[model samples]
Target: MAPVKKHGRRRASVSASELAQMGVCERLVVFEHRYGKRRTVEQQQAIKRGRRAHARFYREGHMDWTRWWRYFIVFLIFGRWLTLCVAKWFQVRKPHHET
Candidate 1:
């Protein structure tokens, strides 16, 4: 019979799913070692769907200050109005004494 070959130690590398599996069950690590881990078609589709949704939300919600100059003007107008209101309030609250 031919001499038996010896396998050397494998380089240690951990992936996100492997860490999650380790958290769930140690046996899952053995199962992954025995049979390679792969995502199911549904899982892949869900990931793609989530990525697309995030991209869509970001695109739709992103601020375009240049295009929204009116909002900036409105904010300045509101600030001026608030200052006027505070001044009027102080004028009305002026201390008065009666003999």
Candidate 2:
């Protein structure tokens, strides 16, 4: 495709932030350009935002403990709640104890 036609090339402006994100994963830049998709719940999970935030509470400096707790609490409540709901649904639908 490249020899005959200049296709599949990104026209991204590739700003500093874009470059930084691309460093993590080029797909991020591509998705951002195509969908303008900002940070999502899944993305937060992938990056372990909750754990990262919670770490600050125990680290050397005791700054921003409130924010840390918020992150930890939200993920514990929402994330664990979602897991429990899915597990219950699967348990009801899944086959088991059959002859």
Best by lDDT: 1
The list of candidate 1 runs beyond 4 A from truth reads: 1-22, 26-37, 64-70, 73-99
Clashes of 2: 0
Best by TM-score: 1
Cα lDDT, model 1, residue 68: 78
Candidate 2 per-residue C-alpha lDDT over 1-99 given as tens digits, one digit per residue, 9 for 90 to 100: 011225756554544555576688876657666667667889769658656776865673555677788899999999999999999998889567775
In model 2, what are the clashing residue pairs, if there are any? Answer: none
Q: How accurate locally, in lDDT, is each candidate?
A: 0.72, 0.68
Candidate 2 lands at a TM-score of 0.30
The C-alpha TM-scores of every prediction are 0.37, 0.30
Q: Model 1 over residues 1-99: C-alpha lDDT tens digits?
A: 111236754546655655787888977677766675667999889879988998988776665644478788988999999999999999888577833
Query: Lowest-lDDT window of 10 residues in candidate 2?
Result: 1-10
